[model samples]
Target chain A: MEAFTQHTGKIVPLDRANVDTDQIIPKQFLKRVERTGFGQYLFYNWRFDTQGNPDPDFELNQEKYADGSILLSGANFGCGSSREHAPWALLDYGFRVVIAPSFADIFYNNCFKNGILPIRLPEETVNTLFQRVAQEITHTLTVDLEANKMEDHNGFSAEFKVEPYRRYCLLNGLDDIAVTLQKADKISSYEKNLPSYYQVQEKQNL
Target chain B: MKPRTLFEKVWDRHVIDQEEGKPATLYIDLHLVHEVTSPQAFEGLRLNGRKVRRPDLTVATMDHNVPTTNRNLPITDETSAKQMNTLAKNCKEFGIRLYDLDDPGQGIVHVIGPELGLTLPGKTIVCGDSHTSTHGAFGALAFGIGTSEVEHVLATQCLQQLKPQTMEVHVKGTLSPGVTAKDVILAIISEIGTDGATGTVIEYTGEAIRNMSMEERMTVCNMSIEAGARAGMVAPDETTFRYLENRTFVPKGEAFEQAKQLWRQLQTDEGASYDKRVVLDASNIAPQVTWGTSPGMGSAVTDRVPDPDSFQSDAERKSARRALEYMGLKPGTPMSEIPVDRVFIGSCTNSRLEDLRMAAQVVKHRKVAPGVRAMVVPGSQEVKKQAEAEGLHEIFLHAGFEWRESGCSMCLAMNDDVLSEGERCASTSNRNFEGRQGRGGRTHLVSPMMAAAAAVHGHFVDIRNWTFKD
Candidate 1:
């Protein structure tokens, strides 16, 4: 995972609410064994027509949103499915930060694991950002995760909250697997003295 | 001892480490893996030169991308077949036990977990799929995880996690005859919006939940994620113990009795505090059907299609209008009048034997409607075998329904058994999200009986007064 102390990028506004992972990186593209290469198929159905041409009518297809690294989406973004492919695609597509009114629990945790910052501003604030981005010639925001704040070059600024542990992991690019293995003794002890009921014997007979 | 909730008790038992400014490091007792979300996790392990931390604790099966029609024929889809092969190779390399496609034990991950007696009371379980909440019915603390956490668990068998706030859904009174567990849960999701349970784990209690069968309890817990809940649980009782007893993998005789005593203690302590409480009158619940995309758009069968203008919020109204447009449905029409092109009755949600029997009872000696193509795909090979032994498959076949082998057929439509674009289906699956069944496919979520009844009528029908042709 890449450390995320700060990122300043253009905001691409997606105005729909309840944007599920099924739409983020549809299930069809989930077949690849490796996590990379999903960015090409991100929002496949929404982004392309039946003939494989990118639909110009789609929000992200418009020129203004192209090459934008910051995604400002609707409430409950990445709602359905626990596939981390949704975050993998978002990260692979060059999105460093995702700002929404809210996000699904699994998706939020996934974004942090992939180093894509998911920030939850109030719904009203998100609406204002969407409006401001639409009106501005080129709207960019700098998110200082270390300072727990987001700001635009103009006059907009707001404080955000991420749990201390999650923030620490993101700021330091910590691998959770290594951090958990440090307490290997605790896990082994619990398994060694397990009750008879908790014992899971080998199922060689099956 | 201070009274503790069922969740707190489970959480406390699993916590190996908790430090200031850090979440607890909780041990995972059971890790269920499947084809779709796990390949990347396994690849991560190989790249890091890591072996599975606990092969004994891990289980694997193929479900999401399996075909329901073909038994021996090689999978025709190149991508799906390769993905399935990847899982088999990874499981063998990692020393994890896998229930192959030909194995009788093979089934949907959630179904096989409980069927094999692996999903036990008071255990902390996880899978790389959202509906892992389905295992919570056994009084276990089960939730879905992302592939990264899947890889983390595979490498360390532990996850750093926070204690989510708890919510109690208390449903009292008896469920009506046609009102099944599916109906009860749909009604609850309707009461609370899709995101209502966000950031919380829901504990379903009261007479309605207590009186349900193990299969029915699973049906209720399976859709917790649809309401944005992290997990759903029901405290273990005699009903729960009876379901696991004598099953494979559970302790035997004297050991089982001793286990029973501890399992009994998994209940929420009397006078335990809860963060929030929402009560439902189970007797009032009717057969449910989702008219729109999200499961939260569900309504009683007798209700009319809601006008988008009826919604109070700006977002909701707009969403409703788009849903109606995408679903190709007209507002103000009675639900029973809505016609469906197909009827599918199987998913992790309602594909157990009990659900099959419930559907068979409605379609017995009757015929499917002329225009409706109805299919019954059992959830597991074990379920398929059991349904065959009881002639449930015959009841479905005699009714013009297609009886097929076990797999996750058309639930998410990852297999060949998918609906064509613009086709409408009365399905027993959980989500009705746009393109969930397939692109441009419209699904109306229903109970087994409701789905069977709809198949005969060629449209959605109110099952409360449905009369069997037989």
Candidate 2:
């Protein structure tokens, strides 16, 4: 995971609510064994037409939001499925920050595990951002993890909240597996004294 | 002396390590794996050169990508065949047992867990699929995890989890005769918006819940993620133990008796409190059918399509309008008047033997309506075998419904059972998201009986009004 401290990027507004993981990356594209290369398939159904041509109607297809790194959307973004592929697709498609009023629990956690920063603001605040993005010719916001602040040049500034541990991990670019293995001794000890009733298999030792 | 909820009791017993500010590392009792999500995790483990900590605790199966038509035929889809083979190789290399496509116990991960008695009370379970909460029906702490966490659990037999708050949903009163567990869960999701229970674990209680069979309880707990809860649980009781008795994974003889004595105490304390409380009158919850793309958007089967203006918030109204447009529905049209192109009677949510029995009773000697294609894909091979032994397959086939082999067939449409574009389906699956069944496919989530009724009438119907000939 890349450390995320500060970045200023253009915004892409979806202007929709309850945008689910299926829409993020459909099940048809989930057959690949490797995680990378999902970017091309991100929002596959919505981004392309029945003929496999790029749909001009989708916001991401428009020239203005093309290559935008920050995703601005309505409330309840990433609402269905526990697929980490949602974040993988978003990050692979070059989205570093996603701002919504709220997010589904598993999707939010998956974003942190990957390098995508999911920011939740008040619904009113999100509405204001949407309006400003529509009005401005170019809207780019800078997200500073160390300061816990988000601000744009044209009088748009706000603070966000992330759990302390998560914030630290993002700032340090820490691999979760490495950090977790620090307490391997404790895991072994716990397993040794596990209650007999806790065994899940036929063999007791395993 | 604290009066702990069933969730807290389970959590306190699983913690292997914890810190004030960091997530606690909790031991995982069971880790269910499937082809679609496990390949990348296995690759990650290989890249890191780490071995599975406890392969015995983990199990794998080939679903989501297997051809549901025939186990003998070769999988024609190149990518899907590669993925299934990948899971098989990984399981064999990692020393984990996999219920291969030909295995009798092979099926949906959530379905096989309970039927085989692997989903015991008071254990922590994790899987790569969102419906893993189905195991929580046995008083277990089960929630879905991402592939990264899957790799993490495989390496340590533990996951670093943040403790979630608790909610108690009381379903008071008795369910009407025609109503089913799918209706109860759909009603709950509609009452609480999709994100209503985010960051919380719900403990279902009250008279109606206690009255539900183990299959029905699993049905309720399976859709907890639809309402944005991490997991849903029911306190273990005689019903839970009875379901477990004599199963393959459950203890035998005196050990079973001792385990039963411990499992009986896995309920919430009398004076325990919850972070939130929701109460629903089961008697009033009629058969539910989702009209929109989201599970939370639905009304009774007899109600008309909802108006966007009637929605509470601006976001809600906007979503409602978009859902109406995509679903090709008008505000004043009755739900019963909407035509369905397909009817699906199987998924992890409602594909058990009981669900099949209910649908068989409704469809016996009655043909599927003209212009509607109906199919029943049993949840597991065991479910299919049992259904056939009871002649349920004959009833469905006689009624013009296609009887198919097990795997997650049309529920996800990952296999060959996809619906054509703009086709509307009455299905028993948990999700109604856009393109979930297939590209441009519109799914109306309903119960087995409701779906059977829809197949007969070619449109949604109030099951309460229909009289069964049998």
Candidate 3:
């Protein structure tokens, strides 16, 4: 995971609501043991043809949005599947931020764990961002986690909400395992005194 | 002070640690693992040089990609075999309990969890699969988590979660015969679109939910994730206790009575307030079927496909239009008249023995419609054995349906059991997303009985009017 303060990048407008995780990354590409190479398979069904050639009509493949590091999407982004692959693929694909009207709970939590910031703006505000980004390839927005603010250089700006703890974790590049390990002593103490069935045994019969 | 909801009662008791600004650290009682989403989490633990903190609480099994046929032979698919091999190796090295392919208890993670008595009332359960909500039928606060959280739980035996607000769905009126829990859940999804219960855990109550059998309660809780709520629950009652009475893993003797005493308290306090409320008249809900790519885009079997123009928002109208196109359905077409090329009557959603019996009763003396391929895949080996004892498999096989081994098959079309491009299927599985059954495939969601009826009729039909042949 990487620390986040602020990021400014060209916006990619995905004009679809309830964009589920399966559409973000299909099931076929989840076979690999490693997580790094999933970016190539992101949106595999929509981004590629049967011949494995990139489809230019897809929003991400369009020349103007090719280098986008920020996504301005419709409401209820990442609505299905609890796969962390959705966030891993987005991060691998050069997306540092996802701005939507709202997000599914598991998907939203996963974004923070993977260091990809997900900002929930009002539906109208998100619609305005999409419209502005659609007008030109160079339209960009800046997300400042420290300030809880998003701004476009053209004077459009809005505020977002993030919990203080999640903000602190993201600002410091703190992964959950590392934070949870802080209570290792307490965890060990609790495990030491568990009952018979709760303890692991050697060569136990079923 | 207001009375607390059942969710708050269970959640508050599990809070082991709470910091002023951070999410609460709630201890977990059980963690269910499967082949697909767990490989990476095990690998992460290996890379970090960490061991499972509580191996006793963790259980692993092979599902998701296992073939429904050829259980006696080796797993033929390279990717599927590799995933299963990795899980077996990891479980052995970590000393976690595993129910491999040949194990009688081996089945879908959600199915085995309940049947083996690992799922109990007042426990906090977590799994890497979304259908973990299936265990919430026993009054457990079970929900799905991502693989990263899976690793976190494996290492610490606890999770940091922000509490979700509660939503209560009250279903009044007696359900008509042939109307099942599948109809109730599908109707709920249709009433409230996909994201209606976002960030909330739903508690189903009232006469309709109370009268359901344990298996039927599991069926209703199973698809809660389809509504974007990761957790759904029904409070423990006499029905729940009866189901767990003599199960292998449940407490026995005096321990059982003590457990029951505590479980009796695991209900909502009278006058409890919820963050949101929904009311449904279960009697009015008919046998339902999804018409489009989403579970929410469903209607009663007797209704016609909805026109996109009927929607107010552009987003809704555009989504409807795209769904209709992908589903190969015309706007005015009757749902029952929609033809099917295949019928799948299995999944974590509806693959219990009771579910199998429902389908068998419909297909006893009837033959599958010509050119319609149908199959009945049981949820687990235990479910299969029970079905076999009741002669349900013979009924299905004699009626021209394939009686296959137990595992997830054609639900997401991850294995050889898949619908080819442009094929339409009547499926009992949750989710009708594009390519869910295969690339360019279309699915109509139905119950086990409706799926059997569809196989015989070669299309979606109202089970209320369906008649078995002499």
Candidate 4:
């Protein structure tokens, strides 16, 4: 997996809350075990009309939001069933950063694992960013992972917080097992002691 | 220091070590594996050249990818067949025990665990599947972990985790007639926002909880994850002991006595303080149904969808509007007016025998609507066999409902069973997320009786009209 730091990208505002995992990537697309190639099918149900044509009425299909890579969404984004595919689809769809008032617990953790930055901002700050993106279709947001801050050209700025250890992991692309394996020598020593302990238990059973 | 609840007692007991300002190292007693999440973990182990440390503590079963309708020896779908084969190969290589599709014990991991008595009180259980919290009803500290965490546990039967704050949710008073434990939990999540229990381990207590059967308690605890809780638990008492008395894995003679004594101490002391307390009166709760995409966005069956402006906050109003638009529901429309094309009654949440009996009671005399297609899937093969013996299957089929085999069918369209695009279903499953039933399928989460009512009416209907003698 790639390390998640920060990036500046044009804002794509999906002004809705409770955007569920199934909507992020429909169940039909989950047929493939490999995580890649889900981006095209992301939001498959909503992006297209009955005839499989791109629904012009959908927010993401509008011309102004076309090339945007940062998604600004409402509260409780990525709610419902825990499918890691939600973040995989979003990351594959070129969303490096997802700014929302709040996010579902499972989806938020999955985003970090997949090298996607999920930033939780206060409702007021999120609304301001939404307004800015709504007003200026081509507006950009700059996210600085090193400083833990986000800002736009219009002087709108906010500080986002993440757990220090998770931040360290995201910065270095370390997963839970990778971190555990760092103490391989210690684990080896622990394994060496296991035989003697089990030998005593075996004698007791006998 | 304040006295701790049982949740804290179990959590503190399982802490093997801690990293400074990071999650603690938690010792795991049992680890369950299913086909979907284990392949990647096993692959990671292979890449690292490591063997499973404690294969004895691990158990594997195939559930998510197994076809419900056909019990053929070899599954037809190439991708699913490949995944199941990979799981079998990995388990064999790692020296782990596996219950494949044909095994008598083969069933949903949650169902089989309890029936076999593997989910003992005070044990720390971890699984890759989210509903692993279903084990918590036995007073165990069980929660879902990621595939990477699954690998970590395989290498060392432990987890590095942050301790969650504890919340004691008290449900007092007698439940009115027709209100079941499923309704009680739905009411709790509705009252407390879907995220209200975030970062907390909830303990369900009081007279109402103590009176619930083991199966009903499991139903309530199973969906605690849906409310954003790490896990939900109830103190193990005589009711729990009775349920496990004859199970295969339970200790016998002297060991049974010793275990029972320890289990009794798992309850919270009087005046134990929690980080938060939520109180609900059981008499007031009614059957609920999701009128929109999110579970928290639901109201009682009799109520209509609230106008967006009725929300206290602008953000909430916007959320309401967005859910309404996606669900194709109009503001101020009575929830009953919204029509349903299908009804599905099965899932880890409400697929027990009690749920089937509840639905069967409603469908016995009434026929399903002309245009509606309905299905009732048992959560396990054992449940299916038991229901058949009790003649519940006949009642469902007589009411024009399809009776099928087990495997998380239609609750999620992981296998062949699915709702056609643009179909709206009244489901007894936990989530009503957009496209959750199938591509472009709309779902309304309701109780089994309500689903049966909708199947008969061909629309959302109040289940209170169906009278039950007991």
DockQ each: 0.67, 0.57, 0.56, 0.29
User: What are the models' TM-scores?
Assistant: 0.98, 0.98, 0.98, 0.92
Show how many residue pairs clash in every candidate, following the order shown: 0, 0, 0, 0
- C-alpha RMSD over true interface residues, each candidate: 1.6, 2.9, 2.0, 5.4
- Write down the TM-score for model 3: 0.98
For model 4, the superposed segments whose C-alpha errors exceed 4 Å read A50-52, A57-67, A182-206, B468-470
Q: Which 10-residue window of candidate 3 chain B scores lowest in summed lDDT? A: B461-470
* Residue pairs with clashing backbones, model 3: none
Evaluate candidate 4 and give its CAPRI docking class based on DockQ: acceptable
Angstrom error at residue B248, model 4: 2.5
Off by over 4 Å in 3: A185-204
- The DockQ-derived docking category for candidate 1 is medium
Q: Write the per-residue lDDT of candidate 4 for residues B19-136, one digit (tens) a residue.
A: 7988777777788988876776787788888788778778888877788876965688888888888888888889887877887667788887887778889888888777887899
Higher-TM-score candidate among 1 and 4? 1
Candidate 2 lDDT, tens digit per residue, B51-135?
Answer: 9888878888887888878678888999999998899899889888788898888999999999888899998999998899999
Q: What is the lDDT, from 0 to 100, of the residue B431 in candidate 2?
A: 92
Q: What clash pairs does model 1 have?
A: none
True contacts kept of 1: 0.61
Ranking by DockQ: 1, 2, 3, 4
In Å, residue B436's CA in model 2 sits off its true spot by: 0.7
**C-alpha lDDT score of every prediction, in listed order:** 0.91, 0.91, 0.89, 0.81
lDDT, candidate 3, A73-123, per-residue tens: 887899878888899999999999999998988899989988999999999
Model 1: residues with Cα > 4 Å off, grouped in runs: A196-203
Tell me the lDDT of model 3 at A133.
75
Candidate 4 residue pairs in clash (backbone atoms < 3 Å) = none
